[model samples]
Target: MAGALLGALLLLELLGGGDGKNEELRLYHHLFDNYDPERRPVKEPEDTVTVTLKVTLTNLISLNEKEETLTTSVWIGVDWQDYRLNFSKDDFGGIETLRVPSELVWLPEIVLENNIDGQFGVAYDANVLVYEGGYLSWLPPAIYRSSCAVEVTYFPFDWQNCSLVFRSQTYNAGEVEFVFGVDEEGETISNIDIDTEAYTENGEWAIDFCPGLIHHHGGSADDPGGIDVVYTLIIRRKPLFYTINIIVPCVLISGLVLLAYFLPAQAGGQKCTVSINVLLAQTVFLFLIAQKTPETSLSVPMLGRYLIFVMVVATIIVVNCVIVLNLSLRTPTTHAASPRLRHVLLELLPRLLGSRAPPEPPRAASPPRRASSVGLLLRAEELILKKPRSELVFEGQRHRHGPWTAALCQSLGAAAPEVRCCVDAVNFVAESTRDQEASGEEVSDWVRMGKALDNVCFWAALVLFGVGSSLIFLGGYFNQVPELPYPPCM
Candidate 1:
């Protein structure tokens, strides 16, 4: 670029006479000396002047989906005629172009109407090219932020159509009117030209075509008309990022919710804990999506709907957990199992479910103590037991009676206190044995209820989960397209 500029200066110097004066130098000096850049071609406010503008989109800075903003940098070119500065190439020694500052001409107050921030600054002062006749051209580079409508119906796999609109701010249609200049190839309308190699490909979005439109606002020929240029950019989002980060994990957590039914109530109530955890995890994911989306409630996001569906299933699983636990812990003593229910819960269900049946109600041995052991206790304890031992053969005889005779007399006196003590001990042990047997039966009922309740819930939850996930995701999958502008059949 430096070399090119140096060569152009050398050519200019050669064109001028070496004696420091020539017709070419005088003609160049006369053209600008009388020219006023501030003057427009016409003075009337109602008169219209058509200006040709060339815009080439250079960079797509960003397209913020959540914020609904489109940021871009572009190179713009404007062309007009300056009648006062007319000059001929024949007199100027074949000099075809004149380089001058941009202030040397009138500039139309053009602006991007849809700009989000409405900033009025552009890339600083650049040179304009003037023909040997009266033709003038100015080119500048600028960055603009424009507002766009976000449609999140098909989010993560959605398509967006955004526009960059350019219009004259000061001159509506009278003083100045804007038109898209011929493309470099001289077509009436310039194409949305972008340098594809330099474009930054977003990980989340794929760029589609950007098409330009020249729009004319309805007005009579006498009235000033409104004209603007719009470049519509159509892009589609990539779903892989959302799928890997959000969908897969959500599905896994939802599957975990299904596992709650299989988790036995005997698993220390972990089934309920797991269901609660899954519910909470889904809530967290939904919150994250809310922060990244618009606050309007017109429609629910696709993933949000899926999470909500999973949460409902998780809730049902939690409720089922409660019911199963209640049944499992029900005691026969507090709530007697109906005879019919006992057959169904303890007998029929286990067979139908192909599961381990609970052990039958317990029964204690009929006799509290062995007869042989009791006989030995009586014989042996008579000598050893201090309290039950008799000290007399007669009322006052302590050491005279033999052991056989002492046992015979004790039996003979049925109402004797020693005889009564032996009967009470045997009866006390028998009553304890009956209490234990009843306790065993109650425990057995609890075990039966647990197995039956588990079977019931496992099947119920499996059905609910299958239906919930299928209906929710499938509905979204089928109706993913946005129904706007027109119901797209494509």
Candidate 2:
């Protein structure tokens, strides 16, 4: 009976332990809290990602006072996921809040761990919800309680050398490790890299710890939080290809064009051709540039601007050619100049200006034609001499005149009397020319006119080349700063 009584007491003790609190704990195992059915979809797998990355930087906002929050923005790569987050005013030490879209959030299974301290930590607010999805099976948010300490090794006391930096570490999981690369199942994440390294570290010193937003995504048990990451804050200037490729080349080419003045126009088409050829070569390079770059409707690139300028200059050159040709065509008399102005201008001016005298002219424009005509006439005269004097005369002369008279006429005609007529004409022309020369110092006005025209052509071509090049080179002074102080989409 005492044993039974002890058993009953033992059963009662067990019954008492099963109370409301215990039942509540048991039920909680199957139930969930803080359920968000409307949570955002995960971000990843987009051909192009667009982000409004604003990196606000402030330096020693009054060094006497304690350093406050300084906010900034930056864009991650396009391949990564994009996330939009809001930052509060007190976040960067006490500057304005910056709203930014982080392109890095687009990657697969990223985990973000925040460990900030004090009221500054409370003031800092970041939203890391999903923005888009190319993958499924995303893990729910997890809160891990831990203290964070950030020790900046070489924090710049002055804002002059400060910059924002974003560092990333990527990992893969069990099954993923076997198939592709960077064994994700391993403890250390593979392929952790900084995307902006190409632009920020080329021998320039800067200081600005611009705070950036961090984004992360995690997978479920089937997918299993395969990646971990860490990010560092850095500040830097965006890459500016316009300054290097476009502005520099345009300036250089323009300077070369301005040198056109140094080339003599009488150099015969070479000066003009050189300028045009340079412009043409630039155009070819421009074509190559266009082919290799992405097509965008956004503002044109600096290189494109340079190309347009060169093409315009090339057109101007064509116009200058017309002008030079016109000058060369000008005559000493009113619109009566022959094409010989090219030679006359090339010749007379240098000699007139105390340079060497002009080259002598060819005896005639074409020597063969004159020689052929003269040879024919001489052959006909020889044939006439071989014939009898009677046969050479008119038909009636043989019957109407005596043989003696005919003989006399033939002797006079054949004995070079006709040659004297040509000689007389030549002598008359020589005397008239000689008299003109004696009166006016023997100068050909045509030759003088040509020289003056060549000088005009040379100067005109030079001016056109100079003006066009100058406008393009000086154009940099007229450029306005970009509306967004960041790099554009590739």
Candidate 3:
């Protein structure tokens, strides 16, 4: 019982000491708490993000002999850090963010120094830089900074044979790079994984690393790596074949069509037939020419213009040929007024537009009894005039002319004026008939000669024109596909 009491007393004292220790700890120490719930104050980094960049181009432009400027646009891509806390959006969902509003990242004026020719001020001019894709978003899980870069280069003349080189220095990033190879069929070719051959999304993008310039054409993650990507594209100057097969044959047929004018209508079966054949040939050529040329509403080709000229000329030939045939089919009675006009306008105009004189009016026949009496008088007067024994005979030949003609020669003989009028009328008709006969033969000869001449001209034109057209086509064929200007970067 005594030991128990001592233990109780000790325990009470120990409890009292523990109580005192608890009171002391409570005065100076505290229990574990959610200190974060106490709302500790913090400061965010400045919203202003600074960026500085310099770009240099190497061999990005080419000039003609005159050094005239070629226009081109370059694309620059930059990836950097932007210190922004928050951003807004518009109803259209466009990122509504504040822009720093500075030309910190810009293209500097580049001056091309051509030492060989000592030409200056012939380089990149002051051109506006079009910006794209520089916005901020705050909806992500974490607040991350964003950055971007652009490709700033120029392609000199037509982009078909131009290359653009762009170099950008990002002060914030140590060395950031990307690879651009021929995106063949959308299959990317990389320097490291070049062995892996891939296809394209479509057949068009057969992107491949240019064989010769590859060493300095591709990009690398390391600082000293180089990249060059050459995109060889096949674009036609005009969407049609400059072919002799088209132009030569067409020109030749056109030349042949010109031959139609030389064929005479009097040739019966052959003349019209030949002209029709030539017309058909020309039609074939026109069809062929249309096929050979591009199907565009653009201006007609020089050759087409010439062919049209030929066709028009040929149509005239055909029309003249028809006229000639009409003249040939005409009877002497129907053509009595103007036989010469018929042959000339109808026949000769087919060869060339030659003028003809108007024909004489037809003679009116006297009554049968009057005609017999005049014939008897004419024969008697002619016999007597030759004898010089009868004055009436001399007068008869003299009166063969018209009354007007006889009156003019009235002093020559007694019955001369009347006799001369009769003889003159008869002689006029006879001479006209003789002239018609001679004209017919001459026209025939002329027609044949013209056909021959036309044949010669057509053949000559064919050979010469064919040779010229062939040379043009051959030159185009041998001509090299223009080399694309591929800079070191792209």
Best by TM-score: 1
For all candidates, the clash counts are 1, 30, 45
lDDT of 3 by residue, 201-234 (tens): 2211122222222224333465344333322222
Ranking by lDDT: 1, 2, 3
Candidate 2 residue lDDT tens string, 1-490 = 3245335545655777445433332222212122222233224432222222222122112111112222222222212222222222232233232211122223332223332122112122233333222211122222222222221111111112222222222433322221111224643212222235333332222322322323334667655444222233332322244446654665566546434434443343665776676687677767755663335444444446556766676566545554554554444344554456544554555555455545665665654444435544555576566754333442223334756775665566558666546656776899989887643422344334434644554455556556754664455444423234323221
Error of 3 at 236 (Å): 7.2
Q: Candidate 3 — which residues are off by over 4 angstroms?
A: 1-209, 212-385, 388-428, 443-449, 480-490
Tell me how candidate 1 scores on lDDT: 0.70
Q: What are the Cα lDDT values of the candidates?
A: 0.70, 0.39, 0.38
Q: What is the lDDT of residue 309 in candidate 1?
A: 79
Q: Could you tell me how far off, in angstroms, the CA of residue 211 lies in candidate 3 after the best superposition?
A: 3.7
TM-score-wise, the better of 2 and 3 is: 2
Q: How close is candidate 2 to the true structure, as a TM-score?
A: 0.33
Per-residue lDDT over 255-354 for candidate 1, one digit per residue giving the tens place of the 0 to 100 score? 8987776666666379889989998999999998888777666667777878887888788778877877787777656787778888888778877888
What TM-score, computed on C-alpha atoms, does each candidate reach? 0.69, 0.33, 0.30
